[model samples]
Target: MVTRREVRLSPSNLNYEDRRCDRCFAEAANGESWPQGPFPGIFAKLDSQQRRYFTDRSTSDIDPTLPPGTLHNGGRVQSAPHAIGGVDFTIRGSMDALLRFDDGSVGVVDFKSSTASPQLGDAYRPQLAAYQWALSRPASDDPEEVSVAGLLVFAPESMVDTEQGRAYLVSTTWIP
Candidate 1:
């Protein structure tokens, strides 16, 4: 006899594993597994560099209309197991960026390495919703009320020869 274990659903998987196929999503929910491709390293480098740039900075640096809140990175969030559409699941994901507004509410910001502005559509909103859920209802930390959620898209436009090395001119777009 076989027993199934609970699944730790990630925001990344919610974008693809759940949206691509119903059978795959159900199988995963039942503890079935599949090999996933390795994440490309370029995005990793971009994330690392941007995190450093935004560290100790303000949200207004990213977007002029933002709340001028303090910027935070590498925030890990996990939600206690709960039911969604009759299926029990837990949200576990690292926030790309979290901003603490002056009013004491938190803003959730996700970064996308892309040439076009990525919309928070069917493929992305669920992931943001998952982050919202985990931040507002974490398994360990005191609950933080989420005031806003959006994306910061980085698009590589041109390459510049710099003193250290070649750097890509990345254009950022804020989608609130």
Candidate 2:
């Protein structure tokens, strides 16, 4: 008898070895495994605000530091189920934002919030690369449309104020 398993892969799991293994094995055994954690309130708020900012560049609150391009949001990219070394798997990821450049090329943008300075470490490379690959093949299996396979990360600086609450300072960085 032959046993078949369906596995789902996400960009977040690219760097997590144990979690990835658990999910893969669970699916192979006809079980399911998902990441568990407490979502932070501040992170949620920041995510919402960033989405809004990308959707409406005309708004006064738009961050001037962001690259000049038309922004897109609320879309997910998925790959057809395929076997990797005999294990069936599907890779999918939700794009935080997509930037359409003046040159008619598209780029991926992921919004990140942190009290500390943000860095594009190796841990994040796979996630961004996945997004780049997905966006490239969107609409068809052709590669002519995908121009850049890189991502820009935006992290805003914040400051604390007793009266007004935690305020995001003017300084922001776009990590390429």
Best by lDDT: 1
RMSD (CA, Å), each prediction? 3.0, 4.9
Tens-digit lDDT track of model 2 for 4-79? 6676667655643434576564553444554558877887787787787657442112344444557667378876
TM-score of 1: 0.87
Give the poorly placed runs of model 2, Cα more than 4 Å off.
1-4, 16-31, 58-68, 115-119, 138-144, 149-166
Residue 128 lDDT (model 1):
82
lDDT of 1 at 158: 95
TM-score of each: 0.87, 0.67
Question: How does model 2 fare in lDDT?
Answer: 0.58
* Clash tally for model 2: 0
Q: Candidate 1, which segments miss by more than 4 Å at Cα?
A: 1-5, 16-18, 84-87, 118-122
Winning candidate number (TM-score)? 1
Q: What does the lDDT read for residue 10 in candidate 1?
A: 82
